[model samples]
Target: MATLEGPDVQASDGESDDGEDIPPLGENDNIDAIVESIWVQMAFDIMYVSPNPKDHRKPAYVLLDQEARTSTTPATFQRSDLTGIFRSVLYRELTSSQWETVVFDSFFPLPNSAALKRQGFRAASYYKKWHHLMARLRRRDIVVVRNELRRQFRTLLWVPHPDTDRMWRTRSSMRGFTRLPASSTGPCPLIAINRQALQGTRITLNPPIDDVEQGEMDEEDF
Candidate 1:
């Protein structure tokens, strides 16, 4: 997901061809699951590059969940296994082009001593991550991609961090960890670990692309 930008819209705008029997998926609640998130990242960014060769020109976006990167979606897919959980969600239909990903470890090996104790993750924290997301939705990279060899919009997937407990959860924002303030168009649609939304065949996530730049960033949470 390069500097994703241009026409970020509600999921309804993008069509879906997902299967009927894919297993359910959720957050990193099962932190000790045999499969590591890093491995899932590797699988999608590499192993699951492309298959049907759909419209490479189709714009796409990914929420890049901090905790549930691989819980349900099968990051790896074969030429014909379009029903894979991860593939189904991201590529709901044959979508997206090249892929690149970051690697992580169960031990959270980064020197950020807190990394080791990383069980699940808080919503938004880093300034760059927050800024980058809003910028993309607000058409940040539209001009550059237009000048280059791509379309004006990028197809994006709304992946949310799960709320392992309802006691601390509600229909939340779709902007990942960032609790972005209301834009000129008001707040983003309530998405996130809402089982009602996540388990549905389609979800509506609207990116109004408004005054996110002027909003405050709560960089300390989770």
Candidate 2:
């Protein structure tokens, strides 16, 4: 028969601060389980990771709220939060080059089934605009875009919330959702939220063709 001795852990009936049902603090469930249970928005601009001698990497950025102020503690960010940075950099580059992604999207109209139409693809009014813009894109442009993005990311002083994200301590690698499936990760807020998926993708309005420039004069269209 088992007998009560030291302070034994007590189980709760799903009672927590703000009615949250939190598991008691212990080394039992592991950080991953605790993180997985959290359904809050994964907008943490900061995080706290216990130090270990075996782990040598550091968090890249300061805590979110402490952005305006200097902080010794590094911020913890969820993998999905990086979408904002990606969008910002992409849009900025596009805007700088006066590329209207919205209009560029018209190249492939949706609910689309028929290919090449009866006019051999010229019948669609958007086809002309799409080709005109695409023709301006040279192989160099693609390379330059890719290079610029890589360079900008390298310049970021911030570190991933989980150092394991920057794993391969001595080697360089891209932040990943797949590289390390078993890697310890921040709570996934985007996936945790209970929401219904959209029935269909949002429709982008067709902008005027006047916004598109003739682009640089090239002897051969790419």
Candidate 3:
């Protein structure tokens, strides 16, 4: 957490005056759970590859799953609740003018089918519009930060794709689903959530990172 010494001192420690943790956007369980679980099957969902530290090499992106989604409508995104620094970093990534390819995870197809449709209602139409915006950004080869699959769900699904199951053929390599036969698309920045897997295994979204402390003491009975 950043320091808060100026006028915004009240916003520090993730708390409100009445004493409640300022919940992250879309952290709700019932609504977000459904969104993430379904997005794991969406056709266009992707996971960026982080670079190797030992080699000291720039990160290279890979296409984990190519046939994840069939949505021709594209994707749209809206950024909210993030700090100015993070938002600026994201914009810089998008405007970096680098050649890039958006890869897919196994979860892409399912979410596209579930969330996108021309239902003729204002809410549904707006939803589709947002997704379209995201797709357009990807077309520009921008590094996106918004949750393409489960934006509403505070949690992420790191599990397997619905269509196929996979197991590790090597300790560091994965088999099953689909692999890049002979595609060398070059290097680009990797985008992923801060949280890691549960017990360093299984696909799972990590909880929020806490840096500040918040507490309150009432003097009612005392």
State which candidate has the highest TM-score: 3
lDDT of every model, 2 decimals: 0.25, 0.24, 0.24
Q: Tell me which of candidates 1 and 3 scores higher on TM-score.
A: 3
Off by over 4 Å in 3: 1-38, 41-44, 47-60, 63-152, 157-186, 196-222
The segments of candidate 2 whose C-alpha lies over 4 angstroms from its true place after superposition are 1-136, 159-222
lDDT (10s digit) by residue, model 2, range 71-144 = 32212211223332211110011121112122112212221223223222334333333232222223343233
Order the numbered candidates by TM-score, best leading.
3, 1, 2
Q: Per model, how many backbone clashes are there?
A: 12, 6, 26
Q: Give the Å shift of residue 52 in candidate 3.
A: 18
What would you estimate as the lDDT of candidate 2? Answer: 0.24
Tens-place lDDT digits, model 1, residues 1-222: 243312341122121121112222223223122123332342343222212223455222223343433333432222122121221121122123211111111111222223312222322122112122222222333233222212211112232222322101222233333333222122222212222223334432333232232233422321
- Against the true structure, what is each candidate's TM-score? 0.18, 0.16, 0.19
Candidate 1 regions off by >4 Å? Answer: 1-37, 41-71, 74-110, 118-156, 162-222
RMSD, one per candidate, in order = 22.7, 26.1, 23.3
